[model samples]
Target: MRLITCSNSAPAYPAPTDTVLRTGAAGGLVPHLLALLRDGGDWLFPVRGRDEPRWPDRIGPVRLRPVPVDETDRRAHYETISVELLLWLFHYLHDTVAEPAFDARLGRAWAAYRRVNAAVADRVPAAADPDALVLVNDYHLMLVPGMLSGRPRVVYAHQVPWCEPDYFGLLPAAVRREILGSLLACHSVVFHSTRWADAFVRCCERYLPGVTRTGETIEHPGGRTRVVAVPLPVDAAAVRALTTADRTGAWRTELDRMADGRRALVRVDRLDLWKNHLRGFAAYDELLRRRPGLADDVWLLAVVARPRHRTPRHLAYESACRAAVARLNETWRRPKGPDPVTLLDATDPADTRHRAIAALSTADVVLINPTYDGFNLVAKEAALASETSRILLSRTAGAHDYLAPLVTSLDPCDVDATATAMQAALDRPVALPDPPSARRLRTAIGADTSADWLAAVLGTPRTGTAGRDVHPTN
Candidate 1:
């Protein structure tokens, strides 16, 4: 069976042919899917618009084909320019509103969207060959499932459909409604959370009542719609093992030096506002202020991803983070206390691994307080890796529902409450499960590897059988 995957963002690397990776955040799922396909299956990974300049150094054992389409392939610059001209003329002829008129910018964005869709259409293979599944992912490729003529199409809902406003900040109401309608035409739809699925169904009911949805609702009279939840899984064993087996011992020393004989507090994530990096810092800062005695004993390692954009908001946030770190250190750094909270940019693989291992080995608490997240894989990885590290998780995270029993929950937006939660975690001792029970839990979760999750949801065949062992390919 051949699977075609389309995502808005490019995969961090090409995955094995048997398991295709698409748009959305890069997390534990990427490696597991690659390993599954490497063991068996053919996979095709296509980015929505542009290809990466260089592929990642590893693809495990699976064979992968990188599908590349030029940004200019779908629409000629001259053609897009002409469409804008016609739109302006049509609006002028109808005497539409003059200042900041509606649907004015949409003309350009629409041209680009149409161009992207056309480019994917140009590359889409014929489905008459049979056994081909078109898997479209996220809002980036909402138009792609509709472009597939004969192939069985599936769309993965990584976020609430109403979150469209986040991506298309200025998209008109009419355009957003149309896009939502267009996206629901897929043969099947899969959401990670029931909350998101319900939100999607409600959105569809309000905007496109007559349209077919991949849900159990009467929208599909013949029972054609297939909508289900497949809470994405993380390889608990692999993460724990990889983290524990940190080949480089330098990270251990770094954590030791930073700890200064005290406990460690940690948060690992991209330095985006959405991730609430600042709010996390605020909680740690409050902890330092309220418990001056603990300030010297608990170090906060806020490892952030490198800044990817130069927008004013992004730059301002980064600046604020840097300033906060400096101020907090100056206020609380002591001769006998833990080293001043370290705000490190762990963006590179080596750096990220270093931080992960250090947190696993030394952290007393792991804070994952994202304002909103499709999934927070680190919470799972951390929980599996360290017996002593207590998890402080955000309630809004998709993984929160699954990791509830394993974590100390907090609202991502509440700094004071999060600070209180952190204190509570520190006051409490680590919770450990029986080794046999941990192993059993790990095995049960491993069965939901990205490949298995995708296969079950799409009703596709998996390469490895019930008793087969799967490994990553070189």
Candidate 2:
């Protein structure tokens, strides 16, 4: 089975040893696919928008070269112009249907979308093999499936296609129809959760006009669209192995020394608005405000955010978070002692791992409050590794649906409610689960590793989960 996975960025980049770029999305998926290919499967990895210093003639002995889309600026202009214009028109039209509060800067979004599409079109071919099964990923490559004459294509939506009413309400009906028609014409559609899947179908009908639902609707489409909610999985065993390393005892000791036998409230997130990091901090701040003595007893450790793109909004948000942390530290000071909340730089991977494991080991509470998330893999990872009490979870996160029982659920939008949950997490007396129970949870999660998800999606025999087992390389 020659399985191919393509994306906007490569799994790894060849940067100078000293000057390293922070690993982001591309860092997340490419490694899993490469690992699987090395183990047993035959795989083809092709990423667009890459400039290698030494252009490889082949990847793992497979002939490799960029596939050109058009002669005129590599079709980038046409592709970008088409998609960005469509996005704005669709967002304007769908705003009333999805939600009135959905606010995305459409003009800014359009500009970014145009740049992304241009890059994608520069890489994808003008025409592709209709017989080769194509698994297109994200909105950046939305036009790829449409370009193929009669291919068995599968689209995996990472975000709500027509999300945020204020944003998606701009697109005209005709453009939306063509986009949905192009996507629905595919053999299958995959979403991270049922909520987004349902929203996607609604967008199709509201904008596509004549589109109708057929068969048992996972989501209602104007035509025969097969939608499935296949949640993404993490590499649980590797996570545990990394966290449970015996050689990292010195780092653990230093972290433990900092803890001073107090309850540790930890959150690991990029400084993004959608992550609700400020709200999470406010919750911890509230916990300290109400129980003055507990402020001295508990420490909130946040991983500092990396410098993202040179966007004004991104810079502004990062500054706001830094200010908030500083204010909290000033407001709740330890009498003649160190700061209550410690903010570590995001680039410190070794420390991040050590602190994450130590937090899981010593946590009285692990808080993950996202404004909206397809699913928070960290929640599951923390839960599996946790030797303490229930996690403080945000209801908007997809993992909330699955791990509700093990979490102290609250609205991510409400700071007060989150504050209350944080207090509850600190005050409530619940005994830690025995080793056997913790082991069982870890086992269940390990069964659904990234390898399992890939195998099932590719129609290969998966490890378990019925006969959906794919062949795993040794």
Candidate 3:
């Protein structure tokens, strides 16, 4: 089958099969999928941006059709729709929309969003093979599957969390209708977990009349969309290479030296509202206060991945997190011991991936406390980073249930509970990778794997040659 993929932004790095995917925010997806698709097959991932035209259409067999839009419309589309509307729609942030020309801006956003998708829809027919599988990723292009004509198998993959019908109802009826209706047009609607998959099914049942959900499949007038939770895996080999002692040994060595031979806890995340960085800091602070002696032992190495465009919220979050760190250091920093809290947001993020992995490699615990994340790959990568490091994960995280059995779970918002769990994880016995449980984790995380994810999304049985991935635990 001919494989075609579409995403809101281009891959962060040069993507699969010698494809030079110009820089954009594709969420490090290219590498994960690159590792997955081991067998040979034709694939295309159409992308759009103001600078997209400079890149060629085809890099070897992988076609990157540039669907460029006007500059002004692109800005309005990216700022309002992709960043604001979709993130707000998912309730990633609790703040109310506060911007000039809110409704009018939303109108422009919707128009630009549609324009990008329509341009992409126009490109599909040229590359459409007899049996084509067009995989649409992210909330940015929910309308693409519906806009495209028949013959190409469409799979709409929602990488983020799906809101409940009541919260989704908050959107204007027309907006919510378009979102659900277009998503229902796909051959499959994939999510990171059964939690979000079930939410999508429920929303379809609530909003779209006559839509029936049988097991994991949603049937509507358009067709059946198999709703499955296929969590994407971390690029384990790449992470291991990054953490190699020769490349970044100083990171862990320094962390241990600073911690005065005690525990070093590393929390690496994009400095975003949804990441709950503030709460994580507060929990750590509380833990230190509760057990002052522990402060000399446990240290927090916050390696935040700063965004390219720092919004007001991002700046404010950075400010607040810094203040908390300063306060923690003032209270707990021992002259001869750990610094108490160190926030590393000033470094070049392009080069920090290896450093973060290196730091986590020597950590006693890794904290991933997202308030409500669709799927936090950092948690998976952290687990892969160390055999002895205990992971303290958020219960609301999409990977929580799958990982909870293996890692310590905590409520993201509960400061007291999080602090308790942090201490517990610090004390938890280090279970070396062994037996049925560890085997399941390794399988779920794309360890020693191939392209079963592609097959699963395409509704085809996994061939013997293809490797493994997380199947629906529900």
Candidate 4:
């Protein structure tokens, strides 16, 4: 079949060894998308830059044709829509209120949304083969299915969390309808978790005007869409290989030396608002305050990946995180004692996987307390890497649906509760080589690869109750 894939990001060649000026963070999806591209397809992406070895032309290898969308621009408003608004919607899932500046931000977000949709509409219809199967990934290209000519078969995959009717209704009436209508324009819509897919159905029923739900099909004024949940899995074998203790590098050596005599509690995340690093540090500090005997016995290795474009808000958040770490080290490291926590920078722009190996391999306990996440791969990665490492999980993370029983759950906002959990983790310690449900977890998370997920996207039918929270079994 002739396949045409659309993504907001393009692959950057000549990476690492010879770095070029990049205006943005290489998004989490870039690597995954490249992996898919390697299997063969024509990928439509915005131009990365002009100075590369081949700028106006292709970048990747043969069998993969890179079609650059020359119409796109590097504007900040797009981020406002893709990151900020969706975050607020997820944040206000139960509540009806939003931030004071939400309305103003929404205005800018819509402008960028229309601009992107318009660009895709103008380019895709002309370039796509009549028999092409268009695969749109994530919210960045949600409107592409509807905008394109009705000839190609389009599949929309929503990789993030979706809100229920009550919260999703926060969008203005026209905007809400537009989004729903656009999604329904596709043959099928897929989500990373059942919770998110069910939420999408609920939103369509309550918010999409004249919407009718018959089984898994949601029929709106424009068209109908089949909703599906196909959780994406990390390359388990690949992650395990990267995190083994035997991996050698300068960074790995330095990191191992740091944890030579102490248990390392590790966290890996981009310095974002929802990652909740500040509160994480506060919990660590509280743990130290309560148990003076445990002082200097643990090392908190916070592996932070810094973005290229540091906005004012991000700058402030990063500064506060650093300040908290500094204050804790100063308070605990008395009389020339070692710092209790070391903020490890994992932003080499070249070899982050190797750098991450340094911390993940040494981890005695892994902390991932994001306030909200669609699904966190780190939990699964840590489990595969160090089966004995205790994982402190956040209640709001989508992985909580299946992982709550296996790991210690915490409300990221509750510093005291998190501190208590931290203590509990240290008290029992890891006796077994793996977690209690190691076999089950391994089976659940490592069952499917991106290829299987893509196949599921192309042909999986709805299997269970919509909006029903069912845990994945081994």
Candidate 5:
């Protein structure tokens, strides 16, 4: 069967030979696509740039088509709209307390957003058969499904706590209706967790009149949309291979030297607002202050990657994080002792991947304290990649759904609680074995590879609790 999927950026399948790196949740979907292609699934995706050659047009059974955006000005406008407006809107990143005002510039950006989606929709039919299964990905192409009405299509949401009615109300009424109507045009919708799925359904019910939900399916004027929750699984074998590689060993040695006999608390994430870098630093500082004896014995290794688009806000956040780290080091560093916190840049993909694996392997505690996340893959990756048994995760993270019972869950907004969890984790016996729940989670994630995830997304019947209520008493 012919399959077509659209995403904002092309996956870096067969990792580039250059030093250029691709990271984040957008590239996270690449491995699953690669697995599908290896298993003989016919797939097609658009490459963004007009200047870049479409070398290796076909990888195994998958085909690559370049959707040229030759106009540089329009391309930038489209990207600005997607990142600054649409992304923030869907991710709930805006400050609701402050009244928001939209000017004509935003209207122009929305127009560019429409143009970008139209460009993607224009390429879909040419790349697929008349009866092909079209799968649109994420908020970037929310309008693509509506554009391809009467065809079998699915749209997958990669963000959490899907848009509420108030969030939608921020947009002009016409734009809001257009987006909801476009989504309703799809035959099916998918999310990484049940919480996000429920939010999406609730938003529809609140905003769109005559919308009805029945057992994970939502019916509206255009069509009935089947909502499915399939948590994205980690490529355990790949992560294992990376962690066990020869380079990883060398990196581990270097990391050990850097640690200087101090226990390492590792956190790997992009420098973004929702990642909660500042709060994490505050928690670590609190941990150091509360346990003076352990201050010289413990270190925070924050392996933060640069943001995809270096907006002003991202730059300011990075500056603030650096200042916080500096302050913590000044206050907590003992005579001739290592800095209490070490920040590492993960801009080079190959080097970053190796360093991350090494950090995970050597970590005594892995801290994944995101204010919100779609699915914090770092938590899962740490579970598989680390020799350590302790992980402190945020309750708001979607990964908490699967790993709550296994991890030390903390309210990321609560600094004292996070500090307490960190202290408790550091104080735990090093010889203590991993919890049975943690082992089960690791096994379950490993067993369900990206191949299985792809099959389920493409309509393969599978039974299990992917969206079960997992409340951990911590």
Candidate 6:
């Protein structure tokens, strides 16, 4: 079977027959994905910055095809239009009160966004067979589905769909129509959760006049598109194995020393604004303030991945988070007690993974708090990889829809409530279950595998009974 997938970043698992098309950036999972693809036979077409070195034509059996896009202009457009504008729009971050400042410059950026997507579209069909199963990923390539038109295309929305008509109507009428029209061109449109899927359909019905929803399918004058909620899957077995591996013995020992018999509250996230690092620090401070007794012993191990795109907002947030951590340490740290917050960089893969495994294995409480997210995979990773049973997860996170019953759910904005929950978790007789029980919980919570997720996306009949119900968004 011929398979073609387009994403801003390459897939973690690229089949030998797969043709993967993506854009190149400084940092992301792309580097890791490239490392894996170096030995595979998959065809990789990367739309790279003009200044970046061209990838070798071949690496073992894998083939590299480069598309050079002007870094200065394209990146300016991408940052402003795609990342700044569209990202905020889709994530529902626009300040309706103060309002968005839409001007001619932004309009130009939108035009460039179209041009870049057109460049990607040109390479997509060129890299695939006429009947290839074409899959487009995330908001970055929203226009590609329409560009591919009649192809057997599937588009996945990795962000929360801005369903509120008023929120969507903020964009120019033509731009709004273009997005919905383009998405409707696909055979199927998938989302990480049923809530997002439902939101997308509602947005279409509100903005596109001819659009009609029947069951999970959205029909328009152009075509019929199936709206499906296929929750992203995790490799639970791999995580479990990583936890048991003895390779990170030194790191685990260091983590144990740092904990010093105190309860470890660990969080692994990028220092992104939406990750809500500042708010998380506030919650931790509140936790210490409310329960003064625990402050002397409890340690918060926050391994933050450096911000990939150092936008002004991200830089400011990162600085503020650091300040908060320092303040907490200065105010609450005991001479021999664990630091209130210990920060680590995820820039180094080996170090990051080792630290992650160490924290997961040794922590008393794992905190997965994000103000809003497509799906917080760390929550699942902690569930599967950690010996810890107590996870304080944010209700706003997409993972909460599925893993809520298993974790102590907390509102990310509610500092007092989150502190109370943390205190209660610490007071529990068993902060974590036995290793065997942890494995059992992992199996029960991780209802789907990546293989199952791919099968569902490609419309192939499932040969295994490992996935959760793919219910209609309605």
Please report the candidate that would top lDDT against the real structure: 5
Which TM-score value belongs to model 4? 0.85
Write the residue-wise lDDT of candidate 5 on 127-240 in tens digits: 345666676777767777777766765555454446667676887777777777888887777777677777778878877889999997798877688776677777777788
In the range 1-474, model 6's lDDT, one tens digit per residue, is 444556565433333444552324222234323433444433323355652253554444555445556675567556887678777776676677864666887777788788777777777645345666665667777787788765765554454444467777888888989988898888888776677777778889888889898987888898788887665666565566667777656778888887777778888887867787777788888877777777767888898877546788778878888888899899898887667789877656556666676677777788887877776777777777664448888876767766654578888888888888888877776744555634554665555555566577556736544343332222
- Residues 206-225, candidate 4: write the lDDT tens digits: 87678888866787777767
**Top candidate (TM-score):** 5
lDDT of 1 at 55: 51
For model 2 the TM-score comes to 0.77
Candidate 1 Cα lDDT to native: 0.58
Stretches off by above 4 angstroms in model 1 are 8-29, 39-103, 157-170, 211-223, 307-310, 335-338, 431-443, 459-474
Question: Cα lDDT of all candidates, in order?
Answer: 0.58, 0.56, 0.71, 0.68, 0.72, 0.68
Give the per-residue lDDT digits (tens) of candidate 2, residues 1-474: 333434443434433442222233412344445554443322222333334324344444332333332233323333333333432232232234653221354434444444444454344333344344445565555654454435454444453223543344445444455456667766667655555565677776666655666532434343355665556666666666756787335556766777777667887666655677788888888777778888788888775455333245457877888888899989988778667887766455435555555555556678898877666677776776665655888776766655555677778878888888888777777674545644554565667766666555554636644122111110
lDDT of 1 by residue, 200-244 (tens): 566565555464654344263223555655566666555655565
Residue 470 displacement (Å), model 4: 6.3
lDDT of 4: 0.68
lDDT of 2 at 449: 62
* Residue 118 local lDDT, model 4: 62
Residue 262's lDDT within candidate 5 is 90
Model 4 CA deviation exceeding 4 Å by range: 14-27, 48-53, 56-73, 87-109, 125-131, 149-152, 244-249, 433-437, 460-474
Off by over 4 Å in 3: 12-27, 36-50, 92-102, 431-436, 443-450, 461-474
Evaluated at residue 193, the lDDT of candidate 4 is 69
Give the clashing pairs for model 4.
none
